[model samples]
Target: MTIHRAHIAGAALASALSMTSSANAQALEYQNTSGGSVTVYGQLNFGYLNFDDGESTTDEIVDNDNSPSRVGMALVQPFGDNQLRFRFETALGLRSSSGISQTEVPDGIDWDRTNIRHFDFAWANPNYGTISLGQGSMATDGVTGADDSGTDVISNVSVSDIAGSFAFRDSTGALTGVELSDAFSTFDGGRRGRIRWDSPEVANFTFSVAHGTEILDEDADTDYTDLAVRYGNDFGDFNVNAALGARRIQPSGSDDEDYVIGSVAVHHAPTGLSFAVAAGSEDGGGDYYYAKLGYARDFFAVGTTAFSIDYYEGDDINGAGTSSDSVGFSVVQSLDSANSEIFATYREYSYSDGTATSYQDANATMIGARWKF
Candidate 1:
């Protein structure tokens, strides 16, 4: 795999931050005499993107879709041994990198109901666990993204989020109409209008299940059912996190699709090293494997500095006899004083369709900052 020299330069620049500022980063909160509290929180992520589609290059400012900018509010009330919580969150709906392409650069902001991430309420009990209702995460959400690597702000198993809409080029330098998003997928679960339940933790293990449908999109009629198990623990100098999940999607009048996905991550505190692996299989469709190596340390008093490299491989994702693969390098530096992070990433994508037609690889580079308040 070829690493872009420009990306290395960008990483160096991103890592060279020396600015310091007073921190006013606490979430805005209000408390009522009734022993209830409401907290407001949000974050903004902005970035510069450079994409090379073999035939040409496109550069633009974008809202990093890797995380996106968003706002949210949480309300909590204690009831004996149980708690009642409500959350409302949505994306800012800026022009995101995942939505941009060589042929299309969306203009202005486009806010819609689809941007709603969580509008849900939950009741939690230490004995029975928690139950949630409304538009929120399904049981399998984040099941394929259990990573202890601090560099996830810029790199993860979801490789296509960076430049997903950019089309691939044929050997003749012509657009092949096959976008990275179409060719690569992690089969991870997502958020939806649903009812979910979680079992109380037992020896660091927890179980969850959910049932839901597509509610934000009026014309869509899809039902989702999922279950997941997660484990997390800190073993003195080492920490580990893992998850396994299964989901079934049934579209109106369409065949059902089933998926199983899992991931594990381990971090060694003394050495500041980490490793993560994820894999998934779609019933009769596609399968993928991903691995990442990472290192992190508090090289500066401000916060931790992290670096990571990852690889992904997929089989039959777009169609039978097709393959998609990618490699990525990333770095992230935390600015504790400002409650923000500066990050950079470089990635290369390749695909094959089992045909005689040859295609050129695509490269993407991004440098971004995320600030939370």
Candidate 2:
């Protein structure tokens, strides 16, 4: 909901005058106001997952393998023709398999944690651009794997939210006792406490930059910097968008790493077809690649239906000579009336050391739903 500052000011004056006049019957709602409206919004997502690592199989309910559930509030206040915006959003781990109290949930995790997603203030002008400060997304948050494929909800480059729980096993189905390598991640950048600025789009192009002390605590804390550029435009029935990003991470007690990431996506509105590809390489002989193809159209009376296939591979992570590969397919159907989606997905994963011998192989299938407001 949005309310003008002028109207709120007038209401406050009227309310003050009404209070002074004891006989007055009418009362204004805004007795004290700073002039802005806050809108609350959120999403709830969960999936029933059946996972198999050859050795064993498990079925359970998980949250946000497709997208993390979150709730947030946004405040918009106009200052003359321009405006100031404030946002506070947090992820909600609705179901905890660990059985820990909410207060005890650890911070900085994307799943199964009440992590603060954004707490930032921004000043924006239609012609000038936007500047943001405080805890928020860095310039390249999702730039590396920007995709227009409608099936990104269930098939994309990122790892599943519950990936941490998937353990690697030997061919005999015996627990190789080795946890999956962290190299599986695609390093698409993420939210951080930082200062960022985005240049107003010109000719369908925008540029951004940011610097922060610590973006994610997953690894050793680092001083980080990122720069990115994005382009979007339409040519006839074909829509095209792409991004290029670079990040430098100076780890506190480890070797510094620099990465260059690029992504391009195209969508055809008439045929409801889409395709995207993303790849990144780090300075220390580490790299990743991802690709997705999808098609979507209104197949049912309710809403649009989408299907897609995606593949990802990472090699020589941080000089550890570990590699990972994944391939998946998904179907998603939107329910416009309920602001929700019904989805099902299947994926296969494989891991290997520097040697060609397979260390682990796993597969999973999931059926899920997501609601947004």
Candidate 3:
């Protein structure tokens, strides 16, 4: 099979740079005598995107939805072995790649209450773990997204974030009216107005549980509950992370929905090689598997350069008997001094509705930059 020249070029560049250390940017912070502190942080992510829907192509400037631009503040106070913290964060609400479609491009920034990511308060102690309330992550959030590849700034298992709004085309070059997002899913949990408790780590493992609702949607009546377990450890030259989670969703007037998800990632620090795998299934609905292979190294004095390739496959995602699959390549080059990264990724999507009519695959390419402060 023929490979895209862009992918080849990225691989070549990574190979050329593989000779160097990694560094990180710091957030702004202020502290008091009582060990109370406030910190502000944010990131800007933007990119150029080109999508081919088998017949026509679209090109535009978009905000990378994989990691959208946003700002936030954190406040912390410590007393003895116990600490209290508060967090407030929101998205900038710019037009995002996942929000754009083949026929429509939103006009401008549209900030709203839904853009809020976190409005949370928590109390923690080394001996007692933590308890949190308000709008924040559920217990299963990121449960299927364990990765140490270092290329996540550009790519991950949430494949549709690149061009989710684009419609698939049939063999005859007609729109099938089925968007990528409708056919692809990770079944991963998200943030909500909830109360959560996390148990203190024991033998490198921690347990979490949460109950929440759709507080941002005034008219919605849904409740969410989940349990998650996570483990992390470093052994000599290898590091590993793993997670398992289960969630239940109950609508006011409908039957409940349930899901289970898990992931594991391993990195060999000395060789800069990493691997990750994730899988999830929705009760009586759909199931999916995802995997990635990656490499990273300090190629320059500035920072590390990372590259990765990933694959995803799902059955009955959109409906019964349907299938969705995708393959992607990504690379990220870090600029330590500027606290930024320049990256690019290419992905191809395929879907089948279990019908007589065949559909063509969709292709998307993105080049972007992210700066954190």
Per-prediction TM-score:
0.92, 0.83, 0.92
Q: What is the overall TM-score of model 1 with all chains considered together?
A: 0.92
lDDT of 1 by residue, 1-373 (tens): 0113322432343234322222235555556556776666677888999999998999999889889888777778899889999998888888898999999999748889999999999999999999999999999999989887788877999999989999999999989879999998988889999999999999999999999999999999999999999999999998999999999999999999999999999999899999999999999999999999999999999999999999999999999999999999999999998889999999999999999978899999999999876
Could you give the C-alpha RMSD of every candidate to the true structure, in order shown?
Answer: 8.5, 7.6, 9.3
Q: Write the residue-wise lDDT of candidate 3 on 248-285 in tens digits.
A: 99999999999999999999999999999999999999
Q: Write the per-residue lDDT of candidate 2 for residues 87-206, one digit (tens) a residue.
A: 877777454222211123333234522267898999988888899998788888888667777777667777444444466776665665444435466666688889898999999999
What local distance difference test score does each model get?
Answer: 0.89, 0.72, 0.89
Worst window of 10 by summed lDDT in candidate 3:
1-10
- Weakest 10 consecutive residues, lDDT, candidate 1? 1-10
- Return the lDDT, model 1, position 302: 90
